[model samples]
Target: MLRITAGKLAGAMRGALVGNSTRVAAVRSLHGTEESAEEFDKRYEKYFSREGIDGWEIRKGMNDLLGMDLVPSPKIVEAGLRAARRVNDIALAIRWLEGCKYKCGDQMATLYPYILEKVTPTLKELGVPTLEELGYDKPELALKSVYDQ
Candidate 1:
């Protein structure tokens, strides 16, 4: 099960919803899956549309749960990474990293580890740091430098 650290239940719910979406997508792509493609599409479409629920309302709820007075992309990325790690799913991690790359920028470096480590070693050869960098060598201070500017 995925765990969310955000104070609000809505944030947790959103995280779970997103994680489930990812899992469903992965399962459908597996070879010789038991679920029919049509069935998988129907289920995913229902969740994607937020049918009975208001999509904007859920977005608002997530905003409130974040409590940072801004849409916290970092928090979302952290949650996704944690969920992927919890499931021991590298593909999920790659998906989450791709999403982060889209949001943060392709050259952001931090979001490219999945590609670098698994797909290619060029980044490591170039001396790029992985997410582990955020946990080492005065990370809080380094992060503050980015956020403070």
Candidate 2:
């Protein structure tokens, strides 16, 4: 006979298997507790630091972090970049780093520098370039647009 479960345990398992953040969040809230920012960042860092993480998972992880409301910690960014490098994806790695800077928003002036300070060594170690270094910081500088072709 097949068994069906609609209990909290089932929801937890489903949340884990489905990788649905909303459902996972609902389950946590229903339990009267939510993860702290540090815990959240640590969890993501651990996720990204997993061995044998493929390109799809790396992109998915970056997208998940980007979709979040808060900016990721420098350690998390470093971990993600390391993962990206592991998957041989320097281009996507740069994009993810840029996404982190964009996430800084109004705090870009203050917080971005701190993130850069913390992650600079890792960036250099991984040989990942920032948008500015790639001349992406000024897209308007392009002499010819793709539309002009």
Taking every candidate in turn, the Cα RMSD to the unseen true structure, in Å, is 19.2, 10.6
lDDT of 2 at 19: 81
TM agreement with the true structure for every prediction? 0.25, 0.72
Q: How much is the lDDT of residue 121 in candidate 1?
A: 42
Candidate with top lDDT is 2
- Steric collisions counted per model: 0, 0
Tens-digit per-residue lDDT, 58-131, candidate 1: 34433343343322244344443444444455454454444444444545556444433452342233333444
Error of 2 at 114 (Å): 1.6
Candidate 2 residue lDDT tens string, 70-128: 89899899999999999898988888889998999999889888998899899899999
Which residue pairs collide, candidate 2?
A: none
Residue 8 error for model 2, in Å? Answer: 38
Off by over 4 Å in 2: 1-28, 142-149
Quantify all predictions' global Cα lDDT against the true fold: 0.45, 0.87
Which TM-score value belongs to model 1? 0.25
Cα lDDT, model 2, residue 62: 90
